[model samples]
Target chain A: MVSRPVGFEQQASSGALGSVDLGPADLVPFDDRGLAYGDGLFETVLLRAGAPVLWEHHRARLALGCDRLGIPFPCQDALDATWQGDPTAELEVLKLILTRGSGGRGYAEPESITPRLLSRRTPFQPVVKRWQEGVRVRLCNLRLGHQPYLAGIKHLNRLENVLARREWRDASIAEGLLADSAGRVVEATSMNVFWQQAGALFTPPLDQCGVAGTLRAALIDQGAVTQAALPLGELSAVDQLWVANSVQGVWPVTTLFSTNGSRLQRWPLPASDPLQCLAHPLLGFA
Target chain B: MVSRPVGFEQQASSGALGSVDLGPADLVPFDDRGLAYGDGLFETVLLRAGAPVLWEHHRARLALGCDRLGIPFPCQDALDATWQGDPTAELEVLKLILTRGSGGRGYAEPESITPRLLSRRTPFQPVVKRWQEGVRVRLCNLRLGHQPYLAGIKHLNRLENVLARREWRDASIAEGLLADSAGRVVEATSMNVFWQQAGALFTPPLDQCGVAGTLRAALIDQGAVTQAALPLGELSAVDQLWVANSVQGVWPVTTLFSTNGSRLQRWPLPASDPLQCLAHPLLGFA
Candidate 1:
């Protein structure tokens, strides 16, 4: 486990990098935009071998999200300084939160936006082995409120995730799956869902809800899966069911239970599903 | 303006109250519930005399919120002990935040919920005079998402409020008003709305959205105003407009403008309306 202090660090002169300690006083000032408006985007990257598993994708998506939220583009040099080129630090899980720095208390953002980037590292843990054994899943009763404008992107306004996560207390059930207001499955508490359908891989399209998982994004890029905007009825027809997120990597679902008393047994992926030969450098499992 | 340390006192087992030098470390032990799930409720009470304004009402609401959230109800005697008889601690503000004391990752709240309650005092400041002069108002473009299950109670999932507050940077405007997904006016960014119409007072019903402010609750109870579900377009017919919240009390709106270029004048509560005399004692305004 990473035994580092869990406080704010000093910002470098560029207002981007360097170590600054943060406390409650910093909460309201670190851009009330972040706290007051959730006007920010964040990425959680699993670092292995001194580099983020999908660093490029994480950075690119963060940039895209920043653009969407109107936050200024992040500087590479400042971001590089955050790592300090410590190759041994690859064992850490980094959570990078970029906020549109404090501006007027109102919503109209300032013309020149200064982004607040907080990069912190925690001890990394791997959950890939769990996929082979599979994990239990429960359906969350709290349906995600939909907003097409904010779907797919990882913006900070996550009260819905917070509420969904609070629905159950059973630790054995690794995750909760959420549906949109219309009862179409969206995602797990913090992961994206995918299923093997008709001998091909299918995952829900996030255009209407759910965060677009980086691992899922990578899988799609590799042609290992196709995006399907399927409703709940189609879920029963799918074969192997799995969930993936940055931190968790991927985990197979062995059991699923719905509030309406529907039960689905485990659907294992076929040998042709490409789980074995996926060539992302971070997919180190042989 | 109140000038004092932001952190509050934590009474020792000796029953002596001493200022707790709580920084980030102290807040950490309080758990992940408050930050992670927003599974809590908070109260910000203005202090006019040595005591918190409307302590009973605030306490009652906190209790109600705790009951609904499944948090343990705190001992009232211990809560009162936090304030003691320090009625002369100088005019200050009291902030109380209660959380389902932290445990369990990902939403299955712990069975034995230990509610964490914090009471801290800061100096008090009232901009009540600003209400008479009337404050500039703007309508937020970001709409409050609907969740009937979570409405009315002051739960921590406040990303909607944060997003709405970030919609503008114009300091000239005092607050931004928000509407629900159905496009009905609900409340101001941090306050509740009440307007004068045809010699009567009308405030939007909180049954579906927005917080039920203590001041608004009191006015409705005292036969001082009528509470009804009103729509955004209905405001155009109002005789005058004002916003009420726990901290800012009642603020008269002199002008209203929608981002799309619609504008309306709302000030000078008609002389015939009893709202002029409806400001409660807890409001500390004439």
Candidate 2:
């Protein structure tokens, strides 16, 4: 495990395991592993009290992602110190990016990998009020490519979301929902979608596509939601709807659009408030 | 047109106007850009001598890719110097990446954007003998997800290839060919495939999926091949087959294996000098 450094130079100079800082010079060099092959995995973590919220879960997910992408996982202590040392950062967003490191020209990977690990703190701003008031959403005309192998992980290959987001400019709509080639509702660009129907909470399964969100997984584990093979036709009958993700917690959906160009009015969530309870403690700004 | 840099530092410092020497840092951080969203397009031009093999074609494709992904065009003169200084560079591989710079954590893009432009030169080595003697290929089990919006261009979302490549460890196979969910042969991981049937050359169309390769386009323009909607069942009827890309040039297919227990017999290319007459000079290396 790599020890934490007091300053940037100390971090840079550290030959320690995962505590190595990829300085700007290394990042903007002629070839970045991130830019080269999209050869990386990342985690967007919500931090509380100068510490990462659900740090273990995030770390485990990162490890799983690395496993799926054939990247080597570093020691947990090294990763912990890399993000934990900033005393000045109390309530913030911590983004941990693990790249395969630079230098292969084409699709071929390097023989020996030097993983680039970045742990940075960002200002945490929650839109909790938006969940209460509800945020409008539109159906993105852009459909996600249906590569089953890449469906659920938060890897760096995010061009699908980029294209979907580029489809609209309306700020009124806080999110955009996407469908697969067979017209199955996948998830929103940045969040996972769940709908309440017949007194049950259900979200589309990521077995085929969409990010397997931490919050979504937690809700499913808590019996707050169940995974369903949702078709586009099933969306219209949904009584209440909400989107779940790590950063925003849970967002209630008031409206959605059907493929036939019709609006589906959404009902609010049921009495259960596990998500609110979970977010209340973890929300960085509290 | 932006002026070319004297060296790497001056280029790295110039943010959007000039080609940045891609290292580890972003002048304007694209951390949120390439990670949270895959908002970028790239082109790999094979450089022989000091000049990129097909500049006009690469430029046109890059422009088309940028338009498809809704990114602003990168400055051309800045990209020109990517291969200028290296006089001793016998063969160079130039990677050009254009990205919409970083933004807040959301799907909505920043308006009035100054896109990130990066170019890097790497030592290029081709499997020239493999192209001449014929190479082996495997049909990947992982299917390509269909998304017409992102079907053709060499955009950054390439988890599909990463996963597909991880399927095999046998170094003998040159590349893995991917098929869409519908069981139609799409293209190779890094190159496009073409087959000859009854004296007519047919390459898979990229309207639904696969990269619209510059070499493939040039081959079509040069009357070396024609586009067709290919089905996997017709592989046995193929008289002669080859894979073409900007970097690999053209590789004759001696064997193809399907992941799902299916195997293909090897077929030799036409044993005549006429093939050399039709092959591109850059493609006819070995």
Candidate 3:
């Protein structure tokens, strides 16, 4: 019941990636499992000069998420064409949402389903201010619930992140830190957190909770960091803290505080950037 | 950007609630928070002769959910109209999915959003067989992680339930049991579970995790049950087991076993029905 669009869209129709090989701007089916139960997976890739940055990592993560969620991935041709499609902007963000098509009431998956692919592009802006001067971070009262099956997957069930992000609204505070109920650090809202102590890099283990971000995974794969179960109480002892994501290479944390503004910690700019080589080289952040 | 549909939809338009008094079937905006972050709540009500059954419980629960998620409720006029709207079906299931409209990005709210509501009706089929003879249930290997802030609310982030339901596909298994990592039973994949022992009715305490089901609430409100900490291991000792929700009222358990089918427990259809008065009388199972 769908009529194909004409050609490559002049601009991503609102959130649509244009009517190119990626398909037209289609309305999300009312019974989409993604919208229904968050039964879907998504990946946000940074685009520069009409080309995607870190395309491999983003695609791999997306595929992993699709596998775990049991949602079928789009064909390779579609994935390739969608990734290469020019977003008609020098800097933009492309989001791919893969849902398990549609289903009726129960949680049981249909024997088969034609997976739905929704791609959209939005303008991307680098955070030179937060990256250079550093940003303040705070502890969220909302704790990350530990679910191993979903740990580290960038699936769409992100209410925890939304709740944590809702904890604070100071646009000035670039990021917020989240911990599991046991007081062990998990990660930051929307970004994975990293710390350097005694010249060794460490990130919170996401096996229990937290999104294993694309940048975080790449950095570790490149031997720039390691994962550990860092406790929130010991965060004050850390030498430096930073948050990383594909869209924004790295945002260094300059100050840390509690919800009541009582417990506090701070870190000064380092002698040199520790993530210079580890971050997505294409991001080209100074 | 949709033309309204007139009259009742014989078949559910995938997710469309059919164009009755709920207004036209509009396409979900691309930036909807529900699809982006599962930032929403939903309620499924059983309808009899085009009239909603247990409307107050579902509406109250939806309001509680919206309050917790900080989403504005649809005005009383809109809610009343939709709730009272005729779906033109004698026996049907109405689903209400309320999302925080659309937002730009990040977890922060958009300051203002007109909550979007999607309603759909599906044919209802009561499980008279299960209600009369207990159905088999198995323990899921996936353990729910504890998150008090999110507990007891039927938020849209239901990947845990989706994953638990994936544990088995046998049409014979009516439901799967889920528990927190501490071995405490939480609830079934969809329904809230209850047990009777020593002439006392107890349900798994939802303070740590699990959705507070509607009928479960009505039953508790009418003094039919109490909350208690239940461990999966202790379930074998219970004299009788039951699962409940507004849709089916109650499905007793004849046999309970582990995911591997190793551990087992069974209770026959007793002399008298313990849930005779508690169940929704309209189901009228013989």
Which one is best on DockQ?
Answer: 3
Worst 10 residues of 3 chain B by lDDT: B1-10
Each candidate's B-chain TM-score, in sequence, is: 0.86, 0.87, 0.89
Highest TM-score: which candidate?
A: 3
Q: Each prediction's Cα lDDT score?
A: 0.64, 0.69, 0.77
Point out where model 2 deviates above 4 Å: A1-28, A87-90, A257-263, A266-286, B1-32, B84-86, B123-125, B260-263, B273-276, B282-286
Ranking by TM-score: 3, 2, 1
Docking class of 3: medium
Estimate, for each residue in B1-286, the C-alpha lDDT of model 2 and write its tens digit.
Answer: 3453333222332233334334443332435475445567788888777677877888888888888887777665556655556444677777777677566445567765656666556676777587568888888888888878778888877767767777777788888888888888889888888887877788888888788888877777888778887787887578877777877777788888878635777776667523334656744364
Which ten-residue region of model 1 chain A has the weakest summed lDDT?
Answer: A1-10
Q: Cα RMSD (Å) per model?
A: 5.9, 4.6, 4.3
Residue A172 of model 1 has an lDDT of 78
TM-score of 1: 0.80
Tens-digit lDDT track of model 2 for A177-231: 8888778889998988877677677888887778888777666666777888778
- Cα-based lDDT at residue B285, candidate 3: 34
RMSD to native, candidate 3: 4.3
- In order of appearance, the predictions have TM-scores of 0.80, 0.87, 0.92
